[model samples]
Structures are given as structure tokens and as C-alpha cells.
Target: MKGYLKAHTHFFLPSEQMAEYLDLPEKTSYSALPPAGDSNQVLPLPDSALTLFYVGGIGAHYKLNAFIDAARSIPQIRVNLVTRKKQWDEAIASYPTFQSPQIHPYHLNANELDDLYAQSHIGVLAVEPSDYRRFAVPLKLFEYLSRGRPILVTEGTEAARIVSSFNAGWVVPYTAEAIAATLRRLQGNRAEVQAKAANAVSAAKVNTWADRARTVADTLTGKSK
Candidate 1:
């Protein structure tokens, strides 16, 4: 560890805040895994009710309850909660409407997300506030954007910046009421959702994995393209 630290001249981190916290050196850059997805992976499902999905980590800090309560409140809106089976089961049981067929929970399978995303209209990015979290972006954010799904992110996440920049989705308060309200809005105004989905795919084109790789390679080789 000691020798490696000295031998390494540059550092590439995912989060700027993380790089600062480490305080390694001035020779630092950020390289997040920008996985670009094909919009064709998910086509509009011919469903009357608007569907939403959350695919990633799940726990208390994730504030998944807000998603649950919000989706539960709007019975017309459907949800797909994909996460680890144990954590998903444990967390979901805390809700009274855990048995609702409208709100489906799945044992996460990274390779099998296309169909799930295909059936959804929006992706939820719900995380509670924290010093570090405020400046850290989530990979799921990129996933949602890449797959042409508008997101429903909390008010204060750093990921919200990207959503705002691309006009990719709505950023609401981290509360069931707020999320429910937004879902209601989208349900009645699906054209708005379609517009945002288009924006998401446009954003994905500029921030794809190929883009990340080329940028990193160019930076490392001191080459200007």
C-alpha cells in the first residue's frame, strides 16, 4: 500500500468529493463508469397507468419507503423495485401494502434489467441527505438516462445536477407526498414524460461508456483529440 501510493502519480476517482476527501494530490481526476444504454432496450409499454422502477442499492439510507409509500398512495401508478432479495424482502415487509401486485419487487439481476426497464416510465433516485452523498452521483442515474427513462430524483442529490442539466426528469423533495404529487402530474401529462425521456437519450449520447473510455485514455496519454 505504501509503495503503491508513492509509485502512483495520478488518481482517477468517481466522485470529486471523494477525491477531495482523500486529499491525495493535485494530479487527480474523476472517472465515473458512464454506462450508455440503448434506448431501444425499453419501448413504451401500452399501459394506461404510468410505471416507475428503482434498480440498485436498497436500505434505510436509500429512503426506499418514500418510493413505496408514494407508489402505494397512487394505486394507478405501478412500480418495479429491484434489489437484493434479502434486503428487498426485509425492507418491503415494513410497508402495509407489501402484498400489492401493482408494486412489484424483484430479486435483482443486473443482466435481466432490460425487460424491467422496458415496462417502466420513470426511474426513482431516492437517497437521504448526507454530507458526502450530496456531492456523489449514483451509477443508476446514468443507467436511467442511458435507457431513455426520465428519473424522479430527490431534491438535494448531486445526481440532480445532471438531471437538471439534461432536463432529464423531475427533482422533488424526499417525501412520499412530493413523489406522489409528481407521479400524479405525470399520469395526467404523459407527453411531458415522453419529452423528458427524449432528453435522457440525448444526454446519454454525449456521456456514454465509449466517451468515458476515450476521455480517460486521452488524458492518460496526454493526447488531445
Candidate 2:
């Protein structure tokens, strides 16, 4: 295909393994949107009861059941899953943990989703380990960072790397025990969580859509290459 095609562009730089597989050049131009909200807002204090917020697909790949299980051990921990009513119903019917008193499921509009983020303490991205995850950066991760919320993401994905690089969140294995342990760690270290929250906002400032757009414009105008 490389020999047959003239050129192509990537929304993001392919992983080293992927580049090697495709026999791509050593360097490639890349572009990505930054955080999607105001970055100047004051960071919220950690909630008294640890609140984990997840808003997205309720499919099996998300591994939200693990989070539900994790919440079971900590009665004070609250888990919120926001999705469409249909998906919510399917999730509750498929997973018993969805019925837990600590778990709350909601169907929210876009504005309400922002409100939900405001009320939450931590943003969660519990993707199951898979090959596709290596290249994908979930949008919710940026949304979480934009809202100045620290993240809890699974290891071995781009999201984990970003969180680690920015010191904006924790990366843990995709298991109930690991999740529960990390939750406890965050709960005991309120100051640490607050620090991470501040870092998230700082990170968002550098990765906003406006910045990405400027990069793209520069590239098109021969100002950058």
C-alpha cells in the first residue's frame, strides 16, 4: 500500500511498534485536540466520600464492572456512570454491582455531563487491555483533565502514559483489587490528589484545541513542517 499510495496523514503518531510494522519513516508529523473546557477555574477540593466518575460507552470493553467491584469494598466510595438510559439498563441487568448503593447511573445531556464532572472527584478510564488501546487516547481523559480532575486509568495505554508524564493521575492494573487499592491510596492522600488536580489543569493549557488548530494552520501555511 505504501508503494501504491501517494501519501497519508495520521491524527496521531503511530506507536513505535505500529510504525515498524508499517515501515514508516523515523519521524512523522502529528496533531491532536487539547482539553475541551476552561483551564483557569480553581481546582475543587477532594470530596469527603471519594467519587469516581465515568461517562461514555457502557460496552464490555470499558470494564466498568471492575470499578463497581472496587467500589464494593469501600462503602464511602461513590461511583457514577453516565450514559444513555438504554445502556444504563443493559449494564444494570448484566452486572449485579451496578445495583450497589454506592453506584449511581445517570443519563445526562452535554451540559449536565459538565455539571457531573464539576461534582466529581476523580475521572475513570478502565479500559480492558487490548491491542487497539495502545494507539487510542480516550477523549474522556482530556475532558477529565480539562475539568481539573485527576484520573484513574488502566496501565498499558496512551492515557496512562499521559497521566504519568503529567503527574495528573494514577495508572493501575485492570482488576478490582488494584482499583480498590488505588482508591484507598487516593483517599488517604487528599493533598496528593489535589496536587494532581492542579497538574491536570496545567496540562490542559498546553493541549487545548486552539493550540492544535494553530499547529495545523502553521503546517498548512508552511510556517511549520
Candidate 3:
């Protein structure tokens, strides 16, 4: 397979073992889109309530229930979840934490989701720890960075590593306690939050879809070493 294929492309690495086994020429890329908002836009430190935004599928693997529970415990923190009605219903039924007033669930279109990202203070991605998650980078992570939102991602995922490397957000255990504690810390340190948000914007500049495309093109064309 390696001999026949010119190159092996991946949205993100599959796994260390798989990469070693394939031993093929590899080009790694991210499924990032151009930022919806202005990358130069400076987000002021939150003086009021800190809002956490999440926009995507509400599958069980996302571990959104933990976020909801954390939000329920933190009255000062606001959570906005944009997803389908069916998923929302299931989540609310399964996790009573969704009943908390701090948790605001909405079904929105692309434009609305973008608007929500602009309004929110932080982005949350609490994926469950799994083999698939270890290497996969969720598209929402890039979108959050592009929109200049500091992220709160679960530890041990590719997204967490990227966020940490870029200093764009907090990476912690996938638990309600950890989420709530991080939110409290961020709420207390507005300056840190602002710094992380700024870092996220900077990361977006390099990780945008156009930049990633050019990198892939360069690799294929033998223009990149």
C-alpha cells in the first residue's frame, strides 16, 4: 500500500502504532475553515458573567453532560449549547443538570452559531477519552480558535495538545469538578482569560483552511521540505 500510494493524507494522525505500521509518506492537515469573525478583533476581558459556547453534535461521546453538570454547580457561569432538538432533549432527559438556568440550549443555523461564538467568552470541548479521540481533532476546536474564543478542552486528546501548545485555552480532566474549577479560576482571573483568547486568535491565523490547503499543496508539489 505504501509503495503504490504517493502520499498518505490525514485530517489528523490516526495513532502512533498505525503510523508506524503504515510507514508511508504522510501529510497531516486540519479540517479548519476560515474564521467567521475578524481575526484582528480584540475581545475585552469579561466583566460580567462568563459564557461558555458549544456548537456541534450532542453525541454521548462529546461528554456534554459533564459540562452541564459543571454549569449547574456554577451559577455565575453561563453555558450556551447550540445543537439539534433531538440531542438536546436526550441530554436534558439524561442529565438533569440541563435544567439549570445557567444552561441555555438553542437550535441555530450557521449564521446564528457564528453570532453565538462572537457573544460567548469561552469554548468548551469535553470529548470522552477514547482511542479515536486521542488522534482526531474536532473541527469545532478550530472554529473556536478562529472565533477568538478561549477553549476548555478535556485532557489527553489531540485538541487538548494543540490548545496547550498554542496557549489558547485550559486543558483538564473530563469531569464536572474539573470543568467547574477551571471556570471559577478563569472568572477570577479575567486577565488570563483575555490572554488566552488573544492566543486563540493568533493560532487561527496559522491554522486557517487556506493556510492548511497551501501546506498540503506545497507538500504534494515538492515545494515543502
- Say which candidate scores most in TM-score: 1
Off by over 4 Å in 2: 1-43, 221-225
The sequence of per-residue lDDT tens digits that candidate 2 reaches over residues 126-145 is 76777777766777787788
lDDT of each: 0.75, 0.75, 0.73
Model 3, C-alpha of 35: deviation from truth (Å): 11
TM-scores of the candidates are 0.85, 0.84, 0.83
How do all the candidates rank in terms of lDDT, highest first? 2, 1, 3
* Candidate 3 local lDDT, 153-185, one digit each (tens): 889877788789899999989888987888888
What TM-score does prediction 1 earn? Answer: 0.85
Deviation (Å) of 33 in candidate 1: 6.2
Clash count per candidate: 0, 1, 0
